[model samples]
Target: MVAGRRSGGRRADRGWTDDAARAGFLGVRATILPALLALGAAPVPADLLIRGAMVVTGSAAPFTGDVAVRGERIVAVGPRLSMRATRTVDAEGLVLAPGFIDPHTHVEDQLLGTDARARLLERFLMQGVTTAFIGNDGGGEADVRAVLASAAARPVGINYASYTGFGTIRRAVLGDADRAPTPAELAAMKALAARAMCDGALGLSSGLYYAPQRFAKTAEVAAVAAEAGRRGGFYDTHLRDESSYSIGLDSAVEEALAIGRASGAAVHIAHIKALGADVEGRAPNVIARIEAARAKGQRVTADQYPWDASGTSLVVALVPGWAQADGRAAMLARLSEARVKAEMQANLRRRGGAEKLLVTSGPIDVKGRTLAQIAAARRLDPVEAAIAVITREDPAVASFNQSERDIRAFMARPWVMTGSDASTGHPRAFGSFARKYAVYVRERRVLDLAGFVTRSSTLAADTFGLKDRGRIAPGAFADLVLFDPRSYAARATYAEPERTAAGVRMVLVNGRVAVEESRLTGVAAGRALRRMPREGTCPA
Candidate 1:
């Protein structure tokens, strides 16, 4: 656990001195102190203070204490701070911790979209997530500079960082051909990854399970990833196979490790899971492999949402990657072929049949219905109905393929952090952190509060090199969440995916109140976080 330790005294006696606190307060102290001195008055020491909350510092065990914020940083953290503040909150019974950091999300559209209210990201705020990472699963745009620029132009309610995506780069250069990139094309792809890293992407992300990206061989991926790695970025990936599809789960893990080895990049598995019945109890084997690699000094880490069902598009869940080459139109045309239809039927059976696949979103009005239900209503075979649905619109599905046993196994690992893999039509988007607390931490005892806070915040911060975040301490960014432990729970369900969570009483982003008393304060204080390019990566 990443415990936040205070020096010079025991935990009970280690409160910040007034001079030290004022010095760290910087310009805020400079502006207010002299004026108050002229009037022979003492300046308020903090802009906002919360007293009597059980503080989970993301590093330290929970303790009843106070935290003071000045400007965008915390200046004081200890039990019973005596300094006065401009505003003080009585948080006698709530639990205060660093705001949850969602390491994987697909909210780029909502963040950069023109819809003002959507940009507030109230769902995440309600769930106590203050920071999210986007452009994941190899879907990030190669133009990192432009995306970050756009986000900066439009203020968002939550801070975010992004990764440049391999799928986008491959598509840009090879146009979904499902063939190995020629030498020049490979060089071009490498250049894009390098430029994205220099332009401030956190890393290179790949969804090898998705089309076009799946087409790239492991060597080709490593070559492209090496560009980001050499520039001091990690490689984040959705493995090419999480089940018995293509190379199988074990080989897919090996492929990811091989990429990390060949590219000299730290490997981060996105939404790590043993999907489908074929891979259901394989969590231990997978964890052992990653642990073995870590023992050999390879930096390997992963994140997982605490949900049994995984989310994906219907086509992605059932369609073969080889058939998806060239694009959707060609894939649709091939659906009529007898051989392709047979393969589709086999894939559907492997996925636990149509009953397990819940159609969540699309142009069709079948949201909340299963493919089996749709098949029966249309008087068609499940595979035929799925094809018909694809012909009209490719809908998203909630594939109930994961086992609770596997989820607990992965969650028990110290290296596994919390991530939502947030996307449209999935309950994980709005409820992952809350659900983790409610089900895993509070109920099942899979993790205690400190472990939850550590994985949800500190681990991601340390892994991604986010400075002064994921902890409650002097000089850390004042992103905090205060919630009623008794009531904190996920309200969203697979059926009601858009429902917000419950029991987050307040949230602070950059020392500004974004949510209070379980309501939005309409503050858009989030900054677009960018990794600084390594010293020689960019032009001087």
Candidate 2:
């Protein structure tokens, strides 16, 4: 069953395939079974009822039916839900699936800029994302509790979760340097992880490829992962290396797997992909490695954006890890050194060249231009251009660099879910989800509507162990999105990255209408989803 946004309508003869019906049946069992306990022999007074449309519950079951939302949970789901509700959404000719959950993002940095609340809600709701996981690639969310406090007070359109970044912990202890942690530094890092989890962090996240985090040893990362495991949290990571920068892609996955196995936490590879033409089709190898670990009963999963090119600082391509360390100030200092400048230039070309890194945001004129173009204007090589951009804008600017083919191949994998990997630095922050539907599903026809929604919605929620979301079942939280499938599209790009998506009409977070008819209602009804205690799921 597929549902799109509309109100006050009754339409029938929604033809669903036999597979869809079977999937819906399975959805009912997985999503609505618990709701049956509360509504046994009693009429449910739900907060909202969505009727007369195909309801795509994110389950293996194949059936079309009505969905009842009671409070924050779905109370009933079936062909005909005989229940009363204060509000009803007519979802004719639309897909009513679970709200999508973005696994990695950096929007938390918006709070650092003051005008955060408005920016966050406007950016997220338009994409129909009910939840976003912050603290990605070891970039933002310096203080977990403080960020959560701000999120709780100001509110936004979507729910937010966090991973206590291993990189952040490393920085807090060892400073932002690319060096291994000493015995005491490792202990201090573990203490910080424990404190973060106590303060409501969902898990430990590591960006081994980035500075500070790169300095961390596998054993050190495993220690932090162990803390998250004790708290019943999962370990999400930006692998040590997905590029040819240093560790190969397979080696990076191995590092993440080792941490998961040693720490007893479910390991999730953040923004899993292989970049550049040289590494094209490396997706299959990466997936095969992850699968091999899964075959061993290890908890392993991966998330990928719908785009092929990834966005990051242009300096990431130019400067080697050694010179890139010490944060922005240290980088600027190194650029001033003749030796460092020459080495950095050679490094960038060796990695992928300046043309590959397209600037997303920086100097007004350079925003959409590529490093190669910027170099031409400056009468310098691409390497010098990268250094110039880093010197002028710092690592704060954005770049768009990923392959379209690689992105689709990654998303098509059963274990691969969705993640923007875009925080503040990239346009994916505002466009990943919508672009997936608009470009891949609608334009390219790479996946059907149901398949696309499942990858972005139900599949993501399940990977994160979010039990109350990802389906439109009764008793599930009223986290919902309404939009016209044909009309849905992403408006943001590297040039104009902050724009919201085009077709999302309404969004509800925790049974509250946070977005109505494609506009934000200034409602911050999102909640923090913490790791819950469970048995048989946690590794010993």
Candidate 3:
């Protein structure tokens, strides 16, 4: 799908670029030019024309201009452009910027095993996100080819690319055993990573904090991540620890930096933060380290959700990795024993408490309750209550452990791009990008509008090797978002996670109108972008 015929490649029957058809107008032009001039009937030749916009042309300040899209690419962008078009949008007071890209996402569920592809992607479309990079937290399927192939067959409205998850690949080869892989096993895992890259995966992703991945040491991870580096790809990681769980947050950052060095891959830390009460104000230390690495000419970048609380499973947030080494059955077995239960309760109490963990999904009756509240209601310990909850369906929790100060610190960094890391019960899945503009830019004035646009779109695209996206320029894909800063807001919250973002006026994916006049057209007008080595350079 990345290399062949695509779903949204067909053009509207405008024939604006047909030279032979235009050649017939030579004799007619003499007569028609004057009459048309007299009548002021010069036609605009474009599939869609966005005019009178304050265009923020990636990394630059906004300027008044017009942007013309013919078929799937922007044909012209300046003060004005002559074109014959059937459709034109009067963006007189609107801001025209590149469609936002979610650098980290978990849309595999929407793309696969569902008939409601349009419904799932509509939330992103409404937020002005035109692309989402799947395979975050090392949870995408191992076979990138098969997964992408299936997704392409059921094409959604937004573009998506994937990473070869080290967790998935490891499980396939070693079956969740905690020991380091054999030499043969390592070779097999490396081979899988290479194959995924060959089949159009963007890079390698790892959730080193989670089970199975925690079992493998640094050297074992390097062996697998090296394949991605060989293809000029990156190592995108959910760091070994976000809190003071095991290695501490700062040490976890060092481990990610070490992987980038060990594997020769450009390193990207997903959801960069100093999480939990023990490490509340340590974001600066992490930033200093990344800055030092960049000074040495090492490519180190990260993505962060703009929310205070980070979303994850109750299992990963509470249960120790050792207890969940094999699977759910194994973890439950440990929970059944008295000694293991006591140890787990102590661990949970030490790392904040049940009061901090707010359940977001599953068991509809207790959906918005905290673990402490659930424990009180059930007349049992919070750890025991959580263990009981995990066994039914592994519901997600919004652990309110992040610091506003640390979040502001990380957001101020140049290399940190916008990613939701959105899961069920998390409002970010529905509204992070819009909040960056509405809350961070207009009201808060964290950064200027241009800087925000650059971070949300262009920076992420270039860093991840996605070509011809994340900008509004000649020859770039016509993925554009039109909005009014005053009107736009991220409307989702913790209790109501299903709400859509407000005030994104229009969105164009591959020159096709997706969200028109603030509503969805339900057009599946996106492509599956593959990794392009030429676009993988960090900007100076």
Candidate 4:
């Protein structure tokens, strides 16, 4: 049985109902009391205590238990912990679980400017997330420590980690040019990547489908990835393509796999999904290929946002790749030219018209409107309308264009983990995890509670090598979430995108309470998690 001991106090309420008492109360009390005292005396009185709840510890199925937290670590886990604490959370009738980890996000630079950081952390807290991985699709700059230090000085609500963006590096060095790096430049890029890792980057991340990075040859990427591997870091990719765009999906997967094999780095596919209706159910084949790669001893994992349509720049929807190459200024210049506009119209027609495109960011007039509506009102063709709207307002308009079947198919995989792929202004930014449970788990019944938690919590921790976290275990980090499963749901929608999610009762980061009773506590207890030394290595 689990161990514990009685303290001087009456102890936290047992929470056992009259019926459950006969079934477990006495037996649990006998095992818990001494174990609690023993744990409390073992060099630390836990900073927090959560007792009498069902805990999904990430190691096994759910069980009724108590958890004790000392400083930032979970010191004891038993049926009822007796540690004295600065604060105690009553979790009766709640599910105590590992805090959700969003494995893919673009919150890095977004948080650096605007009021996005505070708002984004609020949204993440509402969804019961305690930690988030930013820099997906590889768009974060170096100066990792300085960036984190600045963020820390402000009161953020959740923990954060990041991947250094190869795309951003390419932009910094090459400035959106479509040319391969020279040997000296390549060495400089590698050195920058090494410094990022040393400064606490989780790994190297690349977005080959995006500008600058798209021009990089495989060898160029391999050189940087190899440096990350040598430094005990992992590699994550947004792949060269996901849709039926420049590179086919199969080719993109192969390219990512080849990079992992060549560099000896653990690789992850960021937001593994097939866009468009033409490629639905293609995930099974992709998973099989990933499995085959794993069988050959290549470490690979993937994360997915729980939605069909992805939010992104509108320039991608309307313009062909080569035409949009010069970034915003060049695209604006092209829009000003009558000849360039004519050629752009032809390209839009090739993609079966631009009627399906929608506007979601930038100017006020077009923020929530669609291209078809704008075109009809302006009395111009859809192409002209797209150009006018983008040029006058936002060059970047998010689109909704994924199949529902593809979403379900990908979430069913054992290896697939959860991510919002969202920033402050997006609905998913506030509602992703809650929506996954409310819509997919409760309403649709597509996945059970256990299955959903695994994908969103435990599996994410395992994939990212987050030690002593992602689970309610003895001697693990006290990053925990407590919520009402039946009542939990997301209220945010496209119209009211910044709304907080519903029914998350509490959240703890590193044994400190971050949220309580569905309200933020204004606590900033998170720390930058550096890479752990390898086995047999000297201490830092």
Reference-based TM-score of each model: 0.93, 0.86, 0.89, 0.86
Off by over 4 Å in 2: 1-45, 61-64, 111-120, 139-143, 336-343, 395-401, 532-540
Count residue pairs with overlapping backbones in model 2.
Answer: 39
Clash pairs for candidate 1: 3-59, 4-59
Q: List the residue pairs that clash in candidate 3.
A: 44-83, 44-84, 44-85, 45-83, 45-84, 45-85, 46-84
Task: Give the alpha-carbon lDDT of every model.
Answer: 0.86, 0.69, 0.79, 0.71
Please, what are the lDDT tens digits per residue for candidate 4 over residues 1-540?
243222111111111011011223433433444555665543345567787878777666677888877655566777866557766777889988888999887666544445634633778877889888777677866766665565544545566777788887777777777778888888888888877876667778998877768888888898888766766677899888776666777788988999988877789898888865445567777888898998988888888877655666666665656555667788687776777677666545433355555566776767677677778877888877887777765544445656687788878888788888886446787788999999899999888878888888877776666755677665555788899988888888876777889989988887678888989887766654555323232225
Q: How many backbone clashes does candidate 4 have?
A: 12
Q: After superposition, how far is residue 227 of candidate 1 from its true place, in Å?
A: 0.8
lDDT of 3 by residue, 1-540 (tens): 001111122121110121012233332332233244235466436677788899987845678888777667666676765556678788998999988999898877886656755433988999899988889877766677776666456767887778889999999999888999989999999988888876667789999998888888999999899887867777999999888778888889889899899888989999998888788899999999999999999999999988888898888887777888888788887878777677667667645789888899887766899989999999988888988898787788888878878988898888999998877789999999888778788887887888898889978876765555777766566789999878888999888887999998999987788998899987887766656332333221
The candidate that wins on TM-score is 1
lDDT digits (tens) for residues 340-385 of candidate 2:
8787765565446666667766677577777778889989876666
Candidate 3 error regions (>4 Å): 1-44, 337-339, 532-540
TM-score of 1: 0.93
The better-scoring model by TM-score among 1 and 4 is: 1
Worst 10 residues of 2 by lDDT: 12-21
The C-alpha stretches of model 4 lying farther than 4 A from their native spots are 1-47, 82-88, 109-120, 336-355, 393-396, 532-540
Residue 18, candidate 4: Cα error in Å is 44
Candidate 1 lDDT, 1-540, residue by residue in tens? 112442111111111111012244464553444345345575557899899999999776799988888887776777876667999999999999998899999999999888878888998999899999999999888988887776567888988888999999999999989899999999999999988987778889999999989999999999999987787788999999999988999999999999999998889999999988788899999999999999999989999999999999989988888899999889998998898888888788778889999999975557889999999999999999999899988899999999899999999999999999998899999899999999999999999999999999988877777766788876677899999999999999999999999999999998899998999999988877777665666776
lDDT of 4: 0.71
